[model samples]
Target: MDALTAEEADPVADEHGAHQRGGGPGRRPSDAQAVVPPGALSPAERDRSWSRLGDEDFDVVVIGGGVTGAGVALDAATRGLRVALVEARDLASGTSSRSSKLFHGGLRYLEQLEFGLVREALRERELMLTRLAPHLVKPVSFLYPLSHRVWERPYTAAGLLLYDTMGGARSVPGQKHLTRAGALRLFPALRRDALIGGIRYYDAQSDDARHTMTLARTAAQYGAVVRTSTQVTGFVREADRVAGVHVRDVESGAETSVTANVVINCAGVWTDELQRLSGSRGRFRVEASKGVHIVVPRDRIVAESGLILRTEKSVLFVIPWRNHWIIGTTDTEWNLDLAHPAATRADIDYILEHVNSVLATPLTHDDIEGVYAGLRPLLAGESEDTSKLSREHAVARPAPGLIAIAGGKYTTYRVMAADAVDAAAADLPNRIPASITDKVPLLGADGYHALVNQADQLAARHGLHPYRVRHLLDRYGSLVHQVLAEAADDPELLKPVPGSPDYLQVEIVYAASHEGALHLEDVLTRRTRISIEYPHRGVESAEAAARLMGRVLGWDDETAREEVRVYVARVEAERDSQTEPDDQTADARRAAAPEARPRLEATA
Candidate 1:
């Protein structure tokens, strides 16, 4: 389906009756109304989007669709600015989706003496948990292993004390000290030699991809024209300033010009590339730091809480994500395909070796359910070591009407967005309003607390198990009702998808309709998490899932088969390459597979 033609159908108006007044089912009065549904963007609608883009000019145009760009669009739209957000691919298709999934103040930052960054992130974390997106972000506890008996406890305790005193930590429990035996009681999976004791502290986590998609949808609800699979081919310059952009409908190969008074580049790792396109000379460079994570079944690691152990290079986390545990992250420089970062065998071995050090029953490569890699948009420093580089982001106005933001962590996205918009506002003639996003709750956040309390009733009403309903609510909040409504229309949608037992068929349909999912990879890998949660990476279920999506995306039999084939091949290549020793060989093997069409390339 093409993006340009699809926009002309005004699918948003048709699927969600034009006169619909309040927020959709399961939403509160204060929540933003649902402007589009999971099935709103039909094939015809997608083919017509480019023509619509030429009809109107925006005050600000955001170049990337990662967390930062989505946040910028939401902020601009809420402030009554005419805004447009264009992504060359699906929303959150880059580093945004492949994050560590923590909305944290960076406990390690305290040791680095980055007090301001920690405080800012802590404030944003508080806002997200309490006011903004209560339905999506929640508290998660982590045990910091103490290898030494004496100074380790006191040193860690002091840090935890400071962490607790932070603004956002108020909603969660304070840190607790546990003896070796006490710690083992909480996590029997740990090896006796893994630690001398532990200190438990709190952080928060969310589905990064979903949160980013929600941010874009929320911006659309506030009157921003949000479109995905629309790539910015080049900049539209007027005199010496960037006036707008020339965007190509990636799916259809049709181009359109979008005029904007200001352009904010939030392309993460692609920051430098985008700046070059805009003819803006930037002061800093963004280096791609590759981090790979492995996912295993929850049963493999028996623990009451998550574990965080120190590695030779950086910290290693055994995070609890739904029914699975996510263990990861090796920091190394990557100059491979940014669209799909492959984890070499060495990367896998590194993670497995470190994580195995703490496990009573060692996990082999066969035990790994999934492997995924993401690039960190780190600001290049003098040191060659990527780990020592700054996690802090920078906002730059390299040219008139062009503002670029890069190098921040996920937790501090809002601050980065606000600063980017603030910089762009200087070029505009009108007086821009101050950011009220702190008080503006995301689409599903307003009534989340109330709906969570009624989980049992909601489950019974939907004929789902209570725990299943709780899971949906946690991910979608009040919007779970919208998902249920889709199932209400088709009984088959209520059934769980084959292979991936964790998600219902309706979730796949919702991805295309409302979440701006353009391709099969977007649905499986990002919108729903079958790619990371399932051992086969959804390869076994690819055909069935593709058929379901085909019904909505208007994919013919041949196209459906091709999508399944592509997704399957992607999985196979990743799995096969993980057996290769290093990044160069693994990257070459993974690169042998066909590149994803309509790829979203990030730029500054």
Candidate 2:
């Protein structure tokens, strides 16, 4: 290989025998210890960042604030590059937030003999669960139900043995083959006739949106200027190569020019659109594959471990959430709206029909508490089937100073980002360092286990329940104290939101104060997941939560009421849109909801 890819890059074979990833072969270099500021993104911080975007030049400006873009920003910044990460909407507002929420080696890929992809994903999963993000990515087990008797067990076991050993997957427990009775015991929801036995394997899951937001915060802590609700309108082209970006603050409608040595497009499903704007014919085409998921009560499926049922097209996962069972994902072609991908009645019914095949008591539409839809950016290959397209990503320098990355799973975003920066290496002034992100932990990941151990004491000190403190520790890690401190003077901040009791009022406040939530939609949808978790889809909690956020965002009474009204309308629109039969109808219904920040739509 001339120059190996990020995933294929060999670790240095030093005397210490350290197998560190993503440096040139046999290279182990030390990064300078730079003093980083607090990773807090208050309203004041957002203001300062917007002003800086107008005045300063950076080595790299990463477009898109999803996990991939955030990862790229962190990678470049840690290498001593002045980085700026901009997002048109909230972080993870697109595909990143709406996922099956698993960080695992793709099991189905084994059938395709994509051993290398599985190994890479599994290694990345181990890194996340053990070193990188213990606080976010946690171990989750899934049972693969066996239909056939004799050959099935051996065949599945062989694949699993490879899964266990190939990537050195040790952080989580290994695979275990269980008897029929044992499998039923672990997952009572499984039908006795559905299978003869099962294979239990350990993987990991996370709140994808939360994990992405944490990545942005972690990048900010490492001196990357992170700004959301900032849209890149056009490229600042000088002669042949791209020089910078023409940007607009979506919230305030203020236009600015930001000079950067290189521009990275990590704009997931919108990759083609950005490429069109750049007037560059990209190396590959990105097809938007729609995936729709439904959230039902946890009792609907009486399973201790999640179930992975084999579908004709793609796999269906009945994953376990806190109080709900998230069963979904229908992979079909979607040529609809990119921003708000609506789940039609057909999509919802398809999932219910398939999942109900094995359940003793089938879940009705009434059991559904939430509905969400997200698009996958699949690289269009020779096959027309989106599911048949490759999950492997490609990086291209279609132009001199622009690098675009698309078609990777959420589990391997770090590697994707590292490759993107490496593509931009030529434009950078100095020799950029290799990716140290594998060595550097996310902000809340370091002291998370210790915080969990002290959850009981923390609850007593804060006058809250141990369960609540444990929840806080998982969400904020060591920053739990800073979050709880906001509730010190005002005890009401400890009170739960009206419709969604799962989230506290302080979390809503903190979303605005520290999480860069510019609008009520950001709070309910991404920051807290109240929109999907609650039956009313955040309609009941919108007013109360908006009122709390108003205090932090300096919204007057009228603005608060307007925010509530807009959020309620958005919920109504979404619910109504779900009843539509096709993408065209659904898209029109979803677009009826007014944007939280009107200036954003106007400027666009």
Candidate 3:
């Protein structure tokens, strides 16, 4: 290429040998480690993490990189414990990235009388809104349309009153009652006869994948070794006690043993599988519930706020995403593929049927720009309905030195992490300090509010639009400068990606270099969300994004071409799978494509 980006200038090459470009075909420049942002999960950082995993003894070894696993790593590291986190895939590659992207107290949980779960989640939401992740977590208003004229208003009002009393109303506005005409005025898309009145309330939403990745980065900053694409093959045992794990690098298929006092499995749906691999029985069995969501243009829903409707089995939400409306979430048991959960024709029809019940302009499959499915790891219960399973998390020391934590919502991940680490205290040699993650703001959280206030000035300085600056600030927080600075080598990087105007070219490069994106799918899907946000499903920008990512990760012509081909195949498979009638057929079609990580072994 022409010149090396800041993060690409590191001399260290990861185990895959992608970064060894000294006097080679596409040589760039010397080391510029100073330009690399703090807590950046660059290729060099991955190399360092691999070395640490093999050489150092850890107090805690966490097996997973979802929100909860990242949270545990952050909690353990902040408490001065020697910690290392390993993931089979990329960070937030599973359900963590595929969530409905809300940080609110579960309003639906109130009907089940789960007071403690709702209260704890509301507290976390407030912390994220005001103190912890103000840039990422944002306030969003929702309208609950009243169907029945008589008792519905009083019932919803009473429930919302309790919701507000339990810390849900802070940082955001409380509930507001409105007449049918007033509700119609606020949301013109709603049918006149759909409801008699409405109640509006506020909650918080986030980019779940970005939040989880940032958690891992923050954990790395606090002295935790975080490595992705490293799968735990088997457990390392010492007589009657579980001691450590044998992990294989999925990319290179290289094996290494990591010794630890305790191993915490936050593997989500893969919890039971990990327990089986460890030759131990878990305290609770985890059942996978598949939730499917569809994305459409923002204009499709003519509402300033989102909508929450009651379904026969569960509640349905038409949540507002940027430039799009994310309508979702059919909860059903999933016993198929855990890696790539497929959304079927039935699921899409169900969501459309429920959402269209209220909308004046009903949505068709043609209106959907994207479809995604995620699996929630619920604790198995007597009830067959997955929606009825409790969201409360459970932790257990299945073996002497192995701790498994499962069954929690995304909003309460920090609390879950604290609890998991606290469970490991008995096995740890030293008395571990209590969790201080609540007080520790993420890496980019500090000075975020100040930066938001200076958006215009920063935009002027960077030769960009004020709106673009604001968008970057919301996504990167104070690290907006770190992102924008990558354009110093090539001013063209400041321009937006082809076909995807919402994201800049530099952001794709940053994902590969600073955000631990090993594949083009990672950048397009999780890092920037271009895949689900656009009609072309990122195919329009696949080649361009791959080229941008290749520059930072040092991919040659052939490697870049292969990456594009794989991503295109995956997208096509997803589209084809969506047409399938049921889960089995959908999964078969979805699993037909080649995996980005070619050597990644199946968890089974």
Candidate 4:
């Protein structure tokens, strides 16, 4: 897949002009990333970033470390603006980490006639797969099972044909029509009578959490001051215009201020709350829609390709992950907790019921290893149905020095970020350069292909198995050398973690030392993905991970023990919550678990 420039790519995306343009980026494919070992988020780096925040007068300050905020910071930094990114918790600790892990053009949107959104998303997917982060985003095939007779086949085929050509779908193989027998051969797990035929199409998938983390790290390489465990408590106002942010270190509860020419809010579901704190009437309302998914072992579903089924309410995807299948996403209104959205028994049952309808062997509760829930910040509309809510984003300057961006899918975060920075340009002094992030490959992207070719030689040098080295290469790209460097002194760091043997022990150490993990949850949940991959959901690995984190973060034995206790309680809470009847009970149970980073009251 060759990444094409916007002008050469999809003319429809350009013609519609759905997303606001950032002045105009002077970018090209030949641009190289600046060489730097972006300050690792060790204890020392945290102090350094915090000190820099207190001392520097930045051009832009981005509040929210989700994909959009990280993208915003990167966009600003790549354009030669001084930038600071502060997250209340870990990066991608919210919706960014909890997505379906797809980098797809919304196929369902085609039904709603949202050609512009689909075109934009598909173009973005092209960039990620080809040029931007090939190591992170990968291609996957899906079988769209057809239930009805002739009309269904033709209708679906027409849609797939459009999907194939629009937004540079030529990057991957076009959709292939398959007979019922052929479909069954590809996915033997499906019941024979489940479909008449199917369409096999190519789409892209990724590790959302890792991609977001890498985005922030890449921004840091471009001189963006990235700080996690830092919360924006209130807005600093100089008369009517917003001047800066009043911040609190979630770890120390210490108060400080970050002065910036402009502030951009990409707080995801917390956008409304952040706007309220700024004392500005938000341009629009944000509705939180809860989505739930479950993880089951791969052997349970014997298939060569993934399956996408149509539900009465929406679509359900049985996506293939390594060693497991991620099946889910139940959409409904959520008003309880913004931080922790819990998946109830009903949500699990709904997913199981829909997925099992086609499976030859039904998957029971015992088959489920893990479950997670995330909130989608849908822009409110006249329709009461949350499903009808638009994924198209809106950017606004509600007050001077304040810019708010919200309402978009995970696929188009870059476009949204570009629009946001463009909207904040009014607060900037001179004419700022356009977003050059389009040309800037992320931190590990530059040498990814060459490293993949040298995997065997690299593995021999590192004294690790070929398979293990390849895994590291995919996850860290060229930065895998940095991770392996930790094992120079302690060779045992190369050993697999006690309970989670799929990942090396060194990964735990690297998560805290380099990836800005403030607590064990950051390692288990986001950094290494021990939580969702195992049957126990990191319960068995909590103490082991805590030990690794403790050594890096200077946590005493008691502190490490407490961290373990908190993680175990979190796993148990999620487990208990899944047994609950509805969202209210499940939210209550999930919220009962203690927060790893305690939030403080704001004093702006």
Candidate 5:
């Protein structure tokens, strides 16, 4: 079917009706009245959220949908505050989606004597693994190769010992020393001369995009008005004090004003731009540092555990992604477009050279499946080196009733959010409760362990393999049933996407029906890793995924075709950009690609 029948569309109206019943001016829809999942950010919910944003007065209005902004919304809502979060693009469409995907304590930061920052991040990491998002975040082992035989082992071991103890890590195993033979046995892909020995240590990894989206959804469950494709144009100020914001819908090109007691800016790399728009002096300047990562097939590298190597500039990680290996990250200053950070040929070559130096069978350009680049919002420092800039975030009241927060690592987003909300509390009329997000498990986190244990039975019931069920369980946790339930009417939905076998068609439908996926790029790149995991970079599966999404979003055949066309163009543009030698040329090539949300670039 091209579209969902009336019966299927009934749930969409019911979801909106449920919100209308209690989600009045300052109130939220209670769980008892919600016919749909409370966390569902469907297109219907997006409209409702926008309507509420235009009509109601909020205690806090968050500008940005990245991890920190989503975190702020969750922190505020959980503390009994009426909140609204508006994003220019889809959630985690920025730096949040394009991270190293590691929840580490920043082992390099220790050398810089950032002990407090390391401790804070490690604590947050432990929380994610144990209490917060065990389904999405799990223990990942990394082999830190010791090049020098003598002092390196003791030195690295000491740092790791501090790392293990600082966070009160209990769920994951601690560091273990290994001989050169043992290290080689663990990862046969590595060159024997690459290391004298290795120290294996436990850290955490997650789908950063999914985790950030889940954060926004969890906030929605708590009655936060979370809406994407809404761009902030200017501040709504009453004389000197900031009262709210004037926003424009990127999809419709409609303008509206949202009134709030406090407007928290979590714009990340665009912090200065937003500040300029608000006509306020920013407390601290933000410097954009571009980090690029390359993906290759799992078979390219023979490893049981991930590998961490020291580069001349910074540390390079060979992360073990499911069915693939994720190796990256070149840290260089980016002065071009913030919306689309492009990776140059030099960045890719730099990564390949560093990683290939140790790999027994060096990876070639043809082996690369995908390449992505993201900009980190660093607190600008006196040092010329972007790597030297601190990841520690700063919150400032640049103007009355306005607060801006920027510069922090992904691992410590919760803490950064709590601080932002704490700052917003001062501007709020009523006293708010302290942030309880540390205790609040994100949606799908509650019964994740139980679902993991029941994976085999679920597979049997669904007439699928045990591994498939386990994969769904990891991706959706207790909500795996909901994802599978979409395939009820059409059993074909249970099958994999045409070229992207890793993800099922039902996932594309569910992404639009439940998660807030407004565009094909959002689903291909952020909601699922098809764009990065597959060699085709989602182009092969775009049409099928778009049609599936159209069935849920009520798109016509032409619109679905347009989505496919834009997505293919995007992949091509990225490929073209990667061939460029420098940032300026790459930026032009990448920026030339047609946007999924065309109005976003036009309006911004």
Candidate 6:
């Protein structure tokens, strides 16, 4: 079964004269030549993208490409507004990709008495599981350890009962109480003395980066002009109101002014920065909170179910991620580089000390395969304590034609996006409908369930094992067929990439073609799990991955080697930084490597 050739892969034109297969516009002269094929972006296509932005005046311009920004673009475009979304980097390059990978109702939020947030998140979780992205979000169980014997069960059960009543509880099983012996049966990795009993509750998980990227792609299909490597330099103001923005194409260093009726700032941690750029007095400030997580091999932990335990400062999770266990997540206030937040030795030690207290066999630094640190953009309040700061989001229009949204959990990104778009519409000339994204499914979501049912046939057709095909389907949804077509001419693409055991060569090629992976690091760290799954953090596999990417990205030998060197240094610096005692020291060590080319530079 060979992959589809270029000519065979072109999308058919429908009666409306739109290319039904590719993601682009329709019914316009410019739309006819703007079609982009899956699995790669051509230089001509890139140039056309910039030209289209200049040729048309968008009704709304969305800044940022995280989940929230992607959601805003989708909402605005579907509402019949001419929209454009600009990202300084690739989609989900920040906190969106660095989350614990959960699509949960946040049972812990219940403890904070954030009933509204929990209920809203649960409803969104259900929507993702059943309608929006059944392929991306799935149910997973968590074991909550009960240290105290008698009072634990009743107290936990009461909370679980409330959680079940929240919207979309039917998507997963109800919570179950387990005695000490029973709990041990499910998680023998825990020491006998660690807990008296446990309560198992259901929640959901997802591939956050992939889900976010799909949101942007789906918005593009709906007529939103979406481009990465485009930086919002400043706001375009007309007297007292912000009319649009001045943007620079990072790839070509070309500057252009985009005129829109309204502008939405969904920059996440950089929310306040964008506000400052506009010279607008923002209603609220954004504080960066650092969270770090470590990935270790699954064989080191003998747990059938993921574990959620209470720590002195925050909760800890030992999650099952493919062939590894994802652990840690220290939350502390940070005022450092927003691009890369490094984890210190004390941070890692805090997690190991707490988790090892429960594990029968403890883990050490050498056991870690991957380390990632991300900054959460929390809305600033009067409180000096970062943990007590609000997780609820805010939508503010300090200046006319500009809307800024910040401070929300990953699970509630849709609500944040909808609100941002709704606010932007208030400044538009025409009456815009309320957001319909709640019922909207992302790209590849419509036929996901049906494809899952025919995984066997799909696997055989692609010359892949049934399990392998199932994995791809789960990740790509109905897009799996498109990816498999890439390798139709070369059967060997079906085989796994030599150094990266979890991914196939074809997937890497597909990442360059369809997923907007412009650089080697993008492919390794975000497009796939190679960065976190391998012991060397993709250093060993960098050359092979780079070669595969070069074929698509047109990288010369010198450029390929430079990319590999930069990636290797980044991993080394990250490993070295983790040994430091605090944020200041860790950041200094991490900064030893050459800085990643600015997001604008990569796209240019």
Which predicted model would earn the best lDDT? Answer: 3
TM-score of each: 0.91, 0.92, 0.94, 0.92, 0.93, 0.92
TM-score of 6: 0.92
Worst 10-residue stretch by lDDT in candidate 4?
15-24
Ten residues in sequence with the least summed lDDT for candidate 3 = 18-27
Off by over 4 Å in 2: 1-37, 381-391, 601-604
Q: Which is better, 1 or 6, measured by lDDT?
A: 6
lDDT tens digits, residue span 25-111, model 5: 211234124345677887667777878999999999999999999999999989988899999999999999999999989999999
Instruction: Extract clashing residue pairs from model 4.
Output: none
Find the 10 residues in a row with the least total lDDT in model 6.
Answer: 19-28
Estimate the TM-score for candidate 4.
0.92
Per-residue lDDT tens digits of candidate 4, residues 159-277? 98988888876668888999999999999999999999999998999999999999998787677889988899889999999999989998898889999999999998999899899
Pairs that clash in candidate 5: none
Query: Per-residue CA lDDT of candidate 2, range 1-604, in tens?
Result: 1222211221212121221111211112220111112566667667778887889888999999999999999899888889999998889999999999999899889999999999999999999998889888888889999999789999999999888887779988788889999999999987788889999988899999999999998888777889998888899998998988898887778999999999998998988888888887777678999999999888878989998998889899999888998888999888877888888999999999999998878888999999999999988643333221234987877787888888999999998988889889988878878888888788777667877887788787777899988887778776676577557667888988888888888999778777888899998989888888878988889889888887777788898899988989988888999999988898899989988767664322
Please, what are the lDDT tens digits per residue for candidate 6 over residues 1-604? 3433443443432121332222222122432344445322333345556887777788999999999999999898878889888988778889999999998887778888888888888889889888999988999889999998677788889889989879766888899989899999999999999999899988899988888888887777677777888888888889999998999876567899999999998999998789888998788889999988899999999989999989888699999888899996889999887877899988888889889999999999899888898889888743333222234888887788988888898898888888787777669999988889988887778767877888888787777888998889888887776688667666777889878877888888778766777777888888887888899788888998888777666778898898898889998998889889989989899878874454353221
Model 3 TM-score relative to the real fold:
0.94
Which ten residues in a row are the worst by lDDT in model 2?
Answer: 27-36
Error of 1 at 65 (Å): 0.6
The order by descending lDDT is 3, 5, 4, 2, 6, 1
Model 3: lDDT equals: 0.87
Q: Superposing every Cα of model 4 onto the true structure, what RMSD results?
A: 8.6
Query: What lDDT, from 0 to 1, does candidate 1 have?
Result: 0.79
Q: Stretches of candidate 4 above 4 Å error?
A: 1-36, 381-391, 600-604
| Consecutive 10-residue window with the lowest summed lDDT within model 5 | 20-29
